[model samples]
Target: MDDSKGKFGFFADARRLRSFLRQSWRSADASMRRGAVVMWCVGLMFTIFGVVGDVLETWWSSMPFLTNLLTSLTAFFFAVPVALLVLHDVSHRMTDRAGRRAAMAVLAQSMYRLEASVSALGPVEHSRHSPTGGPPLTTGSILEAARARFGRLQDLEGGNAEDIREATETLRTAIAQWKLDRLPDQFIEEVGRVDIEIARLRDAVRPRFLQSDLEWPLDRQLHSLAEMANDLIKRPEQWTIESYNEWCDVAERFSQDFDQKSEITLLEINAVFDLLRHVQAMHIRRTTFVQALHDFNLSARTALWELSSL
Candidate 1:
């Protein structure tokens, strides 16, 4: 006997091939290995039924059709379960992918809204500190006050679109009233226009899963800016030439760097000087919110990747 050959030479290579295939099967992932075993068992059952049916056909010539029908039914029964399993797995994967994609899109869109709102400030000046060299416009006290007003958004998990919209509308009214009291000559008209724009944006806000991921943070930043501005406005004591110069410093910092449209006018340049401090103070909070949003997006992507792997 040759070491490589069996009793028959033809069996040698075929035996090695079977050994190799078994090794390959053992190397597969646990779930896939189980699936392969199940399918192999089903295939073996079908093959056995076919052989048995053919053997029976020789014994009963008049009933050969019955055996043939049994053989076909065996294949059908086995195929139905495999097909259904495949369809179910495919549907589950698709639904999972779609859900992750929708969540990511909603988060991105909410970030976009905040980005646009921030850009609406145009260019901010370098000096973000207070004019008298005290605390900045967005002082800790001012932020605490803003947070007091927005309890839900400051600590939100989830909310319906209508309820969030209503809350934002109420916030808008409060900010508008504060503006009327402080900068009545400028912000009275400006607040109305801002309200109209805000209404349009709010109405356009659609329902989304994980929507609070964006809404709460973005609203928090906006409210903080509003509160800071109102706080600055209330200080008639600081309305000195130095404060005016600090406002000028920030307002004059704007150039055609990013946006083409200029919201600042020579007539309201004085008002813009006053408005500039709020935007300047908002820079820190804006950066904080943006970093938070970035982390959120990263987490969402990681979840999506994990889902894909599964």
Candidate 2:
């Protein structure tokens, strides 16, 4: 009877130990989940706070009167929507991990439907006759196009020198006129100087309208332009009037030598011309868009300033 009692007691203790370990594990898991939630919330809060602070600071510095109003309006209009988005994303991620596939799918479908509806309601066709019709040009777009074309030119074997000169000249001219407020004034002035140099380089490379021009001078100018371009590429930020002038001189000399040696073909020249024209068109479009944005911002800023003063 004692043996039987001892066996029963041992069994009971084993059962109790098992229960205790299971409960402890569950409690630890719950604590970890709670900690993760808290950390996520803290991170989200900080992100929203930083975004709001930045917006307010920019507004205050650029348009003080609009700062409070804009901040409040944005908090209600933009911040609320953004916060909801973040919440939705966090909830979705959590639910997904917890094996809530159906809920995740439903949320995703709802978002897609909402996006489709909004897109359908917006204007589908742009007016061809409108001066501002078609997608507005942006700095990003222009730079992308330039980089692509430059890469293509670099790939060509024994490319027509005149065409290269024309293309480079076009780019130089466009950059000279580019006015990004974010860009320093010194950069702009330097770009303009480079533009002049490119033109000079082009003139030097072209076969003399009259044969009286010395070949050595042309060669020297072409060499100078090539060297200058290489230097500029190395330190694009150091773009100055002096550097540009030197490049133009080198480019002209190189072009003149190229013109003298190569069987002057119209095809290469035409291709180069076409590229230049495209560059010019892009420049005009970008300038117009930037100008429009600048004007709108200026007017808005002025109005806000006046109202604040009153």
Candidate 3:
């Protein structure tokens, strides 16, 4: 019985090997499939040759050539399984490489859309609605800008086949938070209150910031944000851990700029008080946007890297 079990082991091993080969063939691409088919056909032909050669040698015992042929035919038939395994391994490697590249490409596109949406928050001469002859909007008005930017952002084709829902939701939440934090209804009301104080103290008025001067520093801040956005879009390949850390630095700079006091040319102490508060609010929006973008970039980079493991 022990001898019989040992004798049958080779058959059991071959059966397991065949099952593995079938799974590999099923997973392989078109080129590998064709190669597999050809290998199997060759293997079958050699099997037939081995059988016939064996029969011929048995029938014609003097034919030594048939014995040699049968040996070679058996060897070739055995080689086919080995060839199929190698083909499957190569195909799997190629498929993995292609899938990684594809996932990265999708990630890049998503980053582009995200950066564009953030850039839209920067001071624009006109809103997207302006081209359509709707109400003219100012970039400084966070309410209008957020609405316009989010409108376009929400409609973007975000993420790829693998966990697209996760990617999309991450981006959407970041952008929506950016918008929600900046809706300037309260800021506008505060501005109204400050305007009343400015009216009460009309006699003590002096220019703290000329309209141009007020806009200039704010404009510089906007320019910095724009450059950051443009950099992210232009260099999607640089979305690595190092680059993400660098983005955190960039976000910090923007945040610091918000806190950094600008030289304000005072018109009236009371009037300027309200204006400064409004500017502070705008800065908060800018900082929030930058931070949100960094988060989105980080999330996306992590997601793309995880694909390598998969």
Candidate 4:
């Protein structure tokens, strides 16, 4: 089937040209279409005027005015419209191509950054990805993985290394199953890998990304996370004995300075609030990733690798 699609000859070239013109004409601005209509009318008028002027010139053989009028009409209508049309068409095409390239570049960058956020989700793979070199994961699998990991997280007693490890692995498994279209399988597939895939997606749509949905959200999120660091410090990635002692010392000092009841309440409330915010942010990022993929209009079954010739 793919081979057949690749076959191209005179008829194929003609078909492609027809398709291009048809799509371009359909997508063209109304003013441009109107201008095309005006150009066609001008050409027809030029022909008609030249014919009538020739008859008048013949009738008044000695009159230079009739001949000059015909010549001027031909030049004014023919040369001017043709030049304007050429410039308009070329400029539109250049603008269109530039817009598409920029959009693809944005997409490539988003995919790169989004992949980094996915690490928090564990080893989820796109439907086309096989992280372990085993098999491609699917969307269903990733969604399930997210569910199960959330469950595991809830079940944890003390957020011990073992519990976090199991939950993390489960998270990975579900994601590996998710098969986001070749994600976890090769997330390092940034810029270089994603660029090729973005190029493919852009080419498939004829690079018509006149505008993009991905404005500055990626940057905004990163900056927000950096600035909001103090908002959550419930469970650091690692809790050393020294840090535990320090925390205990701080609690003792606070209790000595003030009522221990309020200090304890404050600590509990702060941790819970921080944890809630962190969880909320994580889930939001997940949905954002999913939404971004959906907005890209990527085929459900088309994995990044399968979609493009990397």
Best by TM-score: 3
Query: What C-alpha lDDT, on a 0 to 100 scale, does residue 243 get in candidate 4?
Result: 33
Predicted structure 4, TM vs. truth: 0.34
Which lDDT tens digits does candidate 1 get at residues 148-183?
333443344323444344433433332332332232
Worst 10 residues of 4 by lDDT: 182-191
The lDDT per prediction is: 0.44, 0.43, 0.44, 0.45
The global Cα lDDT (0 to 1) of model 2 is: 0.43
lDDT of 2 by residue, 1-310 (tens): 5553353677677877677544433434455446545555655665576577677775346666665665565445534533444455566456544433332333234334433322332221122222247565444454444445445555564356564554454344334323331233364334334434445434532332113222222344334443444443455643444543343344344345444554334454444445544544534432343343233334433433443353
lDDT of 4 by residue, 271-294 (tens): 433433443344344344434444
**Where is model 3 more than 4 Å wrong at Cα?**
1-19, 49-59, 81-85, 88-91, 94-278, 297-310
Best by lDDT: 4
Worst 10 residues of 3 by lDDT: 208-217
Order by TM-score, highest first = 3, 4, 1, 2
Tens digits of per-residue lDDT, candidate 3, 152-238, equal 333442213332333223323333333333433232232233333223222221122221121112223334444444444454434
Candidate 4 residue-pair clash tally = 18
Cα deviation at 42, candidate 4, in Å, is 3.7
Off by over 4 Å in 4: 1-24, 56-72, 75-90, 110-310
